[model samples]
Every structure is written in structure tokens, then in C-alpha cells.
Target chain A: MDLHVEGVKKVYGDGPTARLALDETSFTVESGQFISIVGPSGCGKSTLLMMMAGLLKPTAGGIRLGSTPISGPPPGVAVVFQDYGRSLFPWMTVGKNLSMAAAADKLPKAEVARRVDEALTAVDLAGTQALYPWQMSGGMQQRVAIARALVVEPTVMLMDEPLAAVDAQTRADLEDLVLALRDRYDMTVAMVTHDIDEAVYVADRVIVLAAHPGRLIADIPVDLGRRDQLTTKAEPEFVKRRAEVFTLVRRPAATSSAGSDAELDGRPSELKA
Target chain B: MPDPSGATSTLTSAPPPPPAGDKAPTTRVPRRKRPFGRRLVSGVSSLWLLVAIAILWQVVATLSPTLYFPPLSKIFVQFGQDWFTGDPSSLFLSQHFFDAALPSLRRLAQGWGLALVVGIPVGILLGRSAVAAAMYFPFIRFWLAEPKSAIIPVAVQIFGIADSMNVFLIFVGTVGLIIVNTADGVAGVDRMTLQTARSLRISPFTLYRRVLVPAAMPGILTGVRVSIGVALILMVISELYATTAGVGYEILLNQQSFKFLQMWSAFLLIGVISVLLNVVLELIEKRVLRWQRREGLSGQ
Candidate 1:
């Protein structure tokens, strides 16, 4: 189902102590689309993702999955957190952790087992079911985290910097793994990342946000024909898109207060002019 | 895009498939499975200092041979007479073994068992809920601070010199520590693990059972170990008051009658029993915490 973040705002505390974390952010992630929300640190990208997952409520407006407003964690939504060591239960074996999603849904024993095995296979961690997360490498543990999300057969998979902790090679491999899984399952994915090229490489469209009360800056579509770890990234069009996002990310003011100066100038030429 | 040059180097290399035998780092540290004879030899080697201490003790006692401090050999003889000597058909365990040692063992079990059964849930409740802890933690802390020995007379008054008084004293001595350690364990549960549980939308019951309890187990087991020691100490103390059948009572009876060697034998037996009980508990702890051993996270 499509996820709608309609005029969502999050302000922590009250009155003078109140700090705006996100300001009237609005976006609709079309069903089955691979969307990446990218920005600088403290851009509230994670906060927005958490709100979308219904783990956090927006201070104003609302988030809706299809027609349902998410007041609490909605069904058919799974989150893959950044810190796999913290996110995955160290006591449980990889299989047990993966199967937890299915078990939480109270699926039949046989069905849960089947889904666990299937999800592990999807993440290329087929035989690691019995191993603990810490026993494996960082990359492998993140795979277990992703496999955990897959077990639920979620309509939307929200990843919060899931590849941030791994090595560069491992990050690329996982990036491809997520893209492959998205294609195979036709999964709707809303990933929050800080890496510009990473956001451009995997996402069908990239939503860029500016920090200090995060607000949407650009909703640029990535149309470099097809994505590849090799040729697609080397393409001129990909470079142009990456530079565009970098410019938007670097110039915080233009995106920080959208259209105010544009209305005065009668043209928003400062960005993508 | 990282310099495509360096990034591409490892791009083609698939993560080495988990090794066939023990390639995974988690599987690398094998639990030591020493042969029985070797384990015994190692055990004996580890106890050499204690053996030396025993020899020194024997030498000192032999040289002095006071009425109160009799020779080790005489005490060993008394010990043999008290528990080891018996008819050939009774497996050489004397009547004193069944009377004195059995009751003591029974009381220890009852007291320690009650402590665990009561302490764990109360601990988890205190750890998880702020209101429950706010209401009860100070009370528990107060109880812990107060001398447990002072409660013996009160217990004797209520239970009237029965086994219940002995069991109650042991319970009083140990339960508070268990509750505290268990609460610490519950509080120490990694934040991310709780977040994972919340994300999964697990029920409150399973959240505690599958997630909270196991996470806090290592701490609870530590509490159990310390509580066992406390329980044994309280058992001996409680038995000294009005008990007639237990090890402590035997020591007091023998001492009052001026059978100093027999009293020493009871003391020796109590020491041996305490060591044996601790060993048993350690073995059980090792078995229960086998996974922790693999992670090298266990206290042992």
C-alpha cells in the first residue's frame, strides 16, 4: 500500500522547551516504489521513518498507509534498524530471530519455519539460522536483520541506515541484495540514508531533506535507465543526479525554507536553475 | 560512489560461505571437553594450595593437641565413625548420615528453592515497572540492610522450633539479594533488544517471557549462586538455635558434651558439604549458561 506522510510535524517538549524536529513534511510513497530519503545528520530522516512505521506519532498531521492512519505500529510494516548487534537478540540464534517476525504474527508452526527458511535464503544466509548474530561478521548480522524484516512479508520495509555499520564492500553487496529483493518481491521500500550515491543508486526516486527542523528540499527522480553497482554509477546522468543532490544538501538555506524566497524572486532559480 | 577502483576489488568476492567444520568465529572457541582423568588431575592440581593448607592445619593441631583443638587424625576418625561406618549392606553410610546430613540437606533445599521461586518474579516486576519498584524497592533494601540473624528468634517464636523456622531463616537471609541481582539483570537488558520486541509488536506476556527473562537470566543465576551461600550460612545459624537433627545441632551437641573431636568432625563435614553444594551449583550454572560460555560473556 502507498504510504502518505501528510503535513507531518514533530516537536519535542512544550512551549519554550519545544524544539521542532520535523516541520510540516509531506510526501506520498507510491505503492511498490523504491524511495530513498537522504540528508545530513540530524535531518530527522530517522524520525520521519519511525513516524512512517508508526513507532513514533507525528506531533501534528498524520501518516497513513493506504486509508489507515497509523496511530501505532501498523500491520504489514517491518523496520530494519542500523545497529544489528543492538537490534538482533544476541541470545537467540539467527533462525530464531528471523522467525520472530512470523512468530509474532502467530502464524502456524510449520508456516513460521517455512517463512524463516525462505527469508534467510532470500538474504543469502540460508544456513546461518543456528548462529548468533555476534558470532557472524557485521555484514552477515545485518543480513539477518533484513531477513527478519522479510519474514513478515511487509508491504513497506523501512530501513534506517542499515548499511552504515558495515565495510564498503559489504555495503555495496547489501545494497545490491536489497535492490534484488525489492525486484523479486515487488516490495515497497522507504530507506533513510546519508550517502548520496547510495540513495541515487538504489532508489527509483530520492527525497532530499534539509536539517534544523527537517523539511523536504527536493523530490528528484533517478532515471539512469537501470541501476548497477558498476555501469549505472559510472553513467553521466547518475553523476549529474548525484551532484544535484550534493548541491541541494550543501546549500541548506534554499531547501530549509521552501518557496518563501522563490515567491519573492518569482522563480526558484537558486536550486536546479 | 567510493573510488570505484578500491570498492570494486572486494565487489566480486562473495562472502566466504560459513566454514564447514568451524569457520564461523562464533564456532571457533570450542568449549574445553577434557577427558575425565585429565579433569580430575587438573582439579587436584588446582586444589594443591588447599591441600598444603590442610597439611599445615594437621601439623599445627598435632603439635598442640589442645582439648578444643584436637588432632586432624582424631577428628577424621570421629568423622568416619559419625557418617562413614555402617553395615556392609547399607553401602557404608552410618545412621548419622541419614539423620543429621539428610535433614540439613532437606532444609537447605527448601530454603534455597523458596528463595528462587519467590525472588525471580518479584525481581522482574520490580525491574520492569517503575511504580512497583518505587513502592517496594526501598522496603526490600531496608530488609537487606537489617541483620537476618535477628529474625531467627522471631521465626522460632512463630514456627515453634519446627523445620519451618529453619527454612524461614534461610529464606529471609537469601531472598533479598536474589531480588536485587535479578532486578539489575532485568534493568541491564540491552535497549535495542527491547526496541526489537516493540517493533515486532510482541504481546506483553511474550515480551517478558521470551525476551526479558532470558536476557536477565545470567544476572538471576548470579543472584542464585550468592543466595545459596547465604542460605547455607542461615541454615547453620538457624539450626544452632533449636534444631536437634542437623549438622549445626550436631556440632553444638558434641561441643556441649565435650566430645571435641566429634564436634570438629561435624565442622569438617559441614565444610565438605558446603564445598560439594557449591560445586554442584557451579556445574548446574555451567550447563544452564552454556551459550554464554560460547560468547565468553559468562562470569565463570
Candidate 2:
């Protein structure tokens, strides 16, 4: 199952008020790869991910899952929203959240139950089914959110800045948890994030996006294998790539539109890939 | 693990041990397991002020033979005589109880129940749509301003000396609270949650049942609780205006006859009903909103 965002553009309003959020963005996410869409605030990183998830419509062009054009949320695609506080139903127990996410497919009782248990187990939250989301720590709540996504048994999982809210330690732990779950499920995942270190750390490929009418500037392949918090980060190649993406991300956006276009288009030829 | 007295103590507080069959769990949720009996004892101890007031009222009313302020002893006697003259088969409830108190209770229940049934959906509609809110909100405000006293007499002209009139008046009195609160609650559900529901591909029906309604429940329940007082007030006033069989009518009747003891008893019954309803509502809220209270309690 492949995802293609072909010539996607987003405009917020009309006439004088119209603001271009994304411009002529095109990219393809191959099956089962973890891609991180990373950039600063006002960058359309989240906007791109939302379009890919079929939660938002592109003003022009289209997003497609396999051969089918994404008009609405396609089956077997799920989103893990960033704000854990605003994601899960506060009134529902953890198990209910997961099961309810799956209830849309109208799976048989046993099958829905199985998916619920399996999803929780994937996040190491199996025994926490009975607890309401608010009963858990912030980190635990995010895990529940991940489990909720997993319950859909998605072929593709789109996450929008999922770790932006948690503490440093929780963020690191969750980063690894997401990777482990990705490997275990063999699901294609696109995570939208702001941290350069995190974007390079977890992604199979880091898709660099620049702010102000966000568009892709560079697509770097990450070759590091079996990454961990310490040594993988310390590797020469890892440091080089991290520094490359960091510098590219940290470079000040041009004040003028013409200036930004020249500076922002790092590799326009590779963007449509 | 089902402890009938709402005891969580018997449920182990220990984190469900990380399963050996899988990777160890990372994030942990701390579960509190306080003894229910201890909680009950401590909770009961806080009612000393209420007891003190009751005792003081009894002593003061006994000493002063005021016409309006009858002694507690005499009021109790009147209550028993007016309410308990029925045979054992009828639970010893009197005919007067059936004529007044019971009718008041029934009208309150109907009007409030109808308002809830009508109000919640309308509230949800208003909450979900700015167009609906904009259209209906001012109308709701205007109607809310006109008190039950004006509503009952005017409405009686149309519905005419009927329980429906009383019920309709109560509904008019309380529906605004429910609608406003419910709309607020529904509107309060954040953007991400709605987005999550869409991403999960939740069907429209399931979205309302699982996401929209539950998310707005705290607001809905708050609205429900706020309206109880309004509903009670409207119930009595509705009876007072029209030809009716209710405690409001009886209170007027007893007052005109100068049966001050019975009037006091009627007022006492209203107080008891109000207290009982609040208590019942709190109990229901504790159960219905167990998730909400659980978080609040965990902080304590």
C-alpha cells in the first residue's frame, strides 16, 4: 500500500484574506517505511500529514492511498493526534477508546476484542484496559493513543507531532516505543515533528520541510541501523546527517518571497519523488 | 473484584505486573484504593453543622410559640397525620399525600424528564452548529426571562387546568438551563478529538454515540444538575396558578385555612424532597461520571 501526495496545495481563505499554507508539495510514501516530516512552526508539516491522512482536502491536486484517491479517511488508515489531552474520549476507559476506534469497521465481537487486546499489548498497556485515560500519567495517555491507532490495524499510521507535549524522559521512551511498534506491525508511518534530533532519530527517511508556504527542501535517507539513545546518536554518519538536517532547518527563512523560494528550494528535483 | 459497597481497597493497588509473555510495560497509572468504610465514616463526620442547626431549630421553635414558626414536634405530628393515614397495603401513604405531594413529584419528573429528552439533542445541535446556536440562543434567552409565574397563567389559557399545563410550564422553565449547558459542553470538545474521530473513520452514528455525547457529558450533567432547582420551583408555581392537585395547591389551601402546622409540614416535605433529589442526583453523578471524579480524587 503506497501513499502519494501529488501536487498538493492548501489555501486557507479567499481573495485578500487567502493565505497559502502549502505550495505545490508532492511526495510518495512507499509501503512500510517510517518517514518524518519535519520543520518549524507555520511550516505545513502538520497540514501535509493531515492531507495524507484524508482528514483534510488539498485545495488542488490530491492524496491517494494505493490507486484510490483520498476523498475522506480511507479504510486501514488511522491518525495519532499530537495533543493526547484532546485525542482520547475522557469519559471512556482505555479499552473502550481502542475498541471504539475499531467499532467503525463493524468487526465481529471476538475480532474487535482481539484487536483491542492486541493493540494494548503492542503498547505494553494490556492490563490497563479498565482504567480511564485521565487515570494514567501523560506518557501512559499517549501510549493509549498509540494503542488506539493500532486498534484500527492500519496499513498506514499518520502521527501529528505526537511527542511535543511529554517530558524529556517520556519523549525518549515513547520515541523508541513508536519505532518498536512500527517494526512489529510493519505499518507505514508518517510522523510530523519539530525536533531535528527526533526527526532524524526515528525516521527511515527524513523529509525536510521549510516554513512559510511550506514545501519540501530536501529528502535525506537515514542509513543508521538498530538505533538507541546513546551510541546510534554518537555514530559519525548519524552526527553528520543530524547536523546537516539541523543546519538546513535552522537556516533563517528569507524575509522576501523571492528570496525564500531560491533559499528554500534545496532540491526541487527530488521533491516529486 | 466487584465490591458491593463501592470499595476499591479489595482491588489490589499493585501495578498489574508486567507480563512475562511480552515486553514490560513502560508508563504506569497509579491506582488508589482507600477503604470505603473509612471514607463513609469520615464523610458522615462532616455533617455536624447540619445536626447542630437541626437541634437549634428544634429548641428555638419549642421555646417560641410563633404562628409561622411552629414547633418541630407539632410539625412532625402534622406530617405523619397528613401523609401516613393510608393502610399498610398502600405503604401507609395518606390520600392527601396522593393529592398533593405525589402529584408535585410526578409533574416535576415529567417536566424535567421531557426537558432533558428535548434539551440534550437540541443542546447538542446548538453546540455542534454555530448557525443553530445563533438562531436559537436569543429566542431561548427571551423565553428564559419570562418567569414561570407569567408562563403558567398565560399557558393555562391554552392548555387549561391540566397536568399538561403544569408539565409544559416546568419544561419551559428548565429547558434553557439544559440547552445552554449542553451547547457549552458540546462546543467544548477540542479540535483534535474531532479530528481523531475522523481519522479513525468512525461512522456518523458511532461518532455521536461514542465521541460527541460522551465528550459533552460533563457539560450535560452540569446542565442537568443546575436545572433541578428551576424545575422544582416551576413545579410548585405551576400548581399554585392553575386548578390543580399538588403540594403547591395544598400549601395554599392549608395557609388560607390557618392550618399553620400542615402548611409547615408541606414546606418541610418540599425541603426533604429537594435534599433527597440532590442526594440522589449526586449519587447518580458519582456513578455516571466515575471517570471525571476518579481524576479529581486521584489529585486528592
Candidate 3:
């Protein structure tokens, strides 16, 4: 099923303190597309992902999966949060954590076990079913989080900077792991990240977002056929896309349509552009 | 994996086949295992201060005993004779153990158990609702701040010298801590975890059972841990207020009769029991939160 974010706008508060978090964001993630959302910190990338996951309500417009407008958490969507350490229940073993995705689906005990096993093994985490998540390294923990998303057998997997809290080496390893997992699961993925190179490295389409009332800026496609952690990064197309996304992120959005000019209002008279 | 695309295994390093012995092949993971006797000795090493204090007390008392400070050896002897003199059928536990210790334990279990069973849910409710928290949190704060002893007279007036009075007093004294900690724990659940649970579409009941409760468990257990000490203190204090047969009452009787040696022995028993209670609670917490522990990865 395809996901559509239709003219969605989010406002934080009302009256004087009202801040526009997102502005009439619209996009349709084609089925099986690997879309990477990249921006500077305040771009509302996480907010957009949360809304897509149906964990947050858009103040205006709506998000739809297939034809259904999502009022609650959507049916065939799963999420991997950035903070892998805190995202998992510190009380459950790796097996129990993955089985949780199947809990409400009412799968049989054996089916739940099968899915859990399959998901872990899919992420190269086979035989770790009995271990606790925290006992593993940060890299391994993130793999379990990814495996958790896989267990749901979701049509769409939304990751909120899932590689942010890991070491550089682990991040590189995980970036490839994610690419492979996407191919293996055949699930559409929308990963929100700030790292420009990573955004271009793994995504088929890199959606550049601008902050100060975050809105979509550009949707650049990466036509790189096959990718490697070493060679693909040095490819001429990859370097150009990285620089393009980097410039868009740093250029400061030209438009802020939510009509809250606090970013400029707080500036000195001469500094106002 | 059953997936035919298992060809992607080259993308990430393969997880070593599960180890047959102790450690995994992952980056040198720390293991807490040691030789049995050494492990025991290391664990016991932490108790050295207590043993040293006991020895000091004994040496001081035997050499130059004071009227107020009775000899430690005599107190130990009294503790043995009083607690271990029951018939064979009673497993050599004396009348004092049956009447005093057993009653104390029963009241402790009931009151403390009621506090936890009732308090955890109430705390979660308080945590979930801003209106409820606003209405009750101040009152709870006032109660917690006020010495629990101040409430004993109120308890006495209602239950009046019955076990209910002691139970009531213990419940009142300790329930506040449990409630406060549980509420804080629930409130302190990681925002990401809650978001993940929401995205997973966990049912309301399952969310509470699987995500909310487990996330708040460390806090709940902290409250339980703190309440253990509070419960023990309250149990003794409640007994002192009024009770016919209890460990606290035994202390009172011995003190009144000037059998300071017996009083001291009863005092030591409370210390022993307090330590035992802490150990038991810790074991339960460790088992419930085995995920938080790394050393004991043996059993499921």
C-alpha cells in the first residue's frame, strides 16, 4: 500500500505562543520506495515520521495508508525509533520484544514464535532470541530494533534517525544492513536522518526538508544501480547529491507559510533579511 | 532465515554460531562468573564492616561492660535460647518465634502486600491523569512528609488494639512511598518507548501490561525497595503502639522487665530479618528484570 501525506499542517500551540511545526506537507511514497528525509534539526522530520506512523495527529489535513485515512496507529506500518536503548522494554528478552509486534495480531503461539525467529534471523541476529537487548552492543541493539519492525511484516517501515546514537563504524555497518533489510523484506522505508552522505548512500529518493516551519524543498533521486560502503560513496553522482542536499539544508528555507515569523522577529532590525 | 534472499548475509558480518561455552564472539563482552569459592568470598567481603562492628561491640562489652551496653555474647545466647527452644514438631523454633516473629511477619506481609497491590494501580492512575494527580498529589505529599507515627492514633481509634490496627498503620505508613515512586516511574517512561508502543498499535490493556508496566518497573521496584525499609520500621513502630504478641512487643516486655539482654537479642533479630527481607526483594527484582542484569544469564 502507498502512503500519502496530504497537505498536512501541524501547529504546536494557540495564541501568541503558537509555533508552526510543519506546513502543508504533501507527498506520496510509492510502494517499495526507499525515501530518506534529510534536514537540519528543526525540520520537523521526526514529527512528520511520527504522523506517518499514525502516532501523532496532524492539526490539518490527514495521512492515509492505501485509501484509509489514519485516525489511529495504521495497520500495516511499523516504526524504529532513534533511541534504541530506551525504545525497547528493558524488562523483556530479545525474543519477547519481537513477539510483542505480533501480540495484538492474535497470531497463534507457534506463529508468533516463528515470526520472531524469522525476523531476528532476517537481521542476522539469529540465536540471539534469548539475550536481553541492552546486553548487546549499540549496533546489535539497533539490529534488534530493525528486526522488531520486520516482525510486524509491515508494508511501510518508518525509522526516526535510527542510526543516530551509534558509533561511526557501527553506523556505517547499520546503513548497509538497512539497505539489505529493505531489499530482503521488500518493504517501503522512509528514514528520517540528518547525515547527508548516509541519506544519499542508502535512499533511492532523498527528500530534502527545510526548517522554520518545515516544508519539503526538493525531492532528488539517486539512480545509483548498486551500492557499496566503500566505492559507492566515492561515486561522482553520490558526491553531487550529498552536496546538493547539504546546501538545501544549510540555505535556510525561503518560505515560512505558517505566518509565524518568530525566527526573523527575534532578529535585530539590520539582520532581518 | 527462511528468506531466499539470505544472500544479503554478506552485507553485515555474520553473528557467530551461538557459543557452546560461556561467552559470545562479539566484542569482548564482560562476564561476571568466577570460581565458586572466590565468588562467595567476594560477596561476603562486603559484609566485613558488619562483622568488624559486631566484633568491636563484643570486645568492648566483655572487657568493660556498661549497664546500658550489655555484653554482645550474652545477647547472642539469649537470642539462641529464645528463638531455638521450640519442640521438635515446631522445627526447634521457640514460643517467641511463633508468637512474636510469626505475627510480625504475617502483619508485615498483609500490610505491605496490600500497599503494593493497591498502591501500584492507584499510582499508575494518578500518573495517567493530570486532574487526578492535581487533586491527590498534594494530599499524598502532605501525608508522606508528616511522620507516619502521627497517624497511629487515628488507626488505633478505628481498629482499636486489633491486628487491623497494626495492619492499618503499616499500610498507611508505606503505601505513600509506593504510590509516589510508581507514579513517578510511570511518568518517567521513555518518550520513545511510548511512541514505539503507539506505532505498534498495542491495545490499551496490552500496552499497560507489556510496555508501561515494564518501563515503570524499575521505579516501582525502587519504591518497593525503599518501602521494605519503611515497612520494617513501620511494622515495629506499629507493634510498639499496641500489640499483644509481636517481635516489637517482645522488645517492649523485655525492656519493661529490665531483661536488657533479651531486648538486645530481639533487636538483633529485627536487623537479621531486615537484611533477609532486602535479599528476598532483590532476588525477586532481579528475576523480574533479568534484562537489566548481565551476570546471571543462565536461566530464562
Interface RMSD, in order shown: 7.9, 9.2, 6.4
Chain B: TM-scores of all predictions? 0.82, 0.81, 0.84
Give each model a TM-score. 0.88, 0.88, 0.87
Q: Which TM-score value belongs to model 3?
A: 0.87
**Model 2 alpha-carbon miss at residue B223, Å:** 2.3
lDDT per residue as tens, model 3, A1-273? 889989887877766567777777788999999999998887789999989988888989899898999888877788999888778777887889999988878889998898887787776666677777766766778888999998878889999999998878778767877777777778899999989989999899998887766777788999887678778988999989888888888885664233334433321222211
After the best TM-score superposition of candidate 2, give how far the Cα of residue B185 lies from its true spot, in angstroms. 1.5
Candidate structures ordered by DockQ, highest first: 3, 2, 1
Better of 1 and 2 by DockQ: 2
True contacts kept of each: 0.25, 0.43, 0.40
Q: What lDDT would each prediction earn against the true structure?
A: 0.82, 0.81, 0.82
Off by more than 4 A, model 3: A234-240, A255-273, B1-30, B33-70, B294-300
lDDT of 3 by residue, B133-186 (tens): 999999999999999888888888998998998888888888999999999999
Off by over 4 Å in 2: A255-273, B1-57, B294-300
For each candidate, the DockQ is 0.28, 0.36, 0.37
How much is A32 displaced in model 2, in angstroms? 1.8
Model 1: native contacts recovered, as a fraction: 0.25
Clashing pairs in 2: none
lDDT of 3 at B139: 98
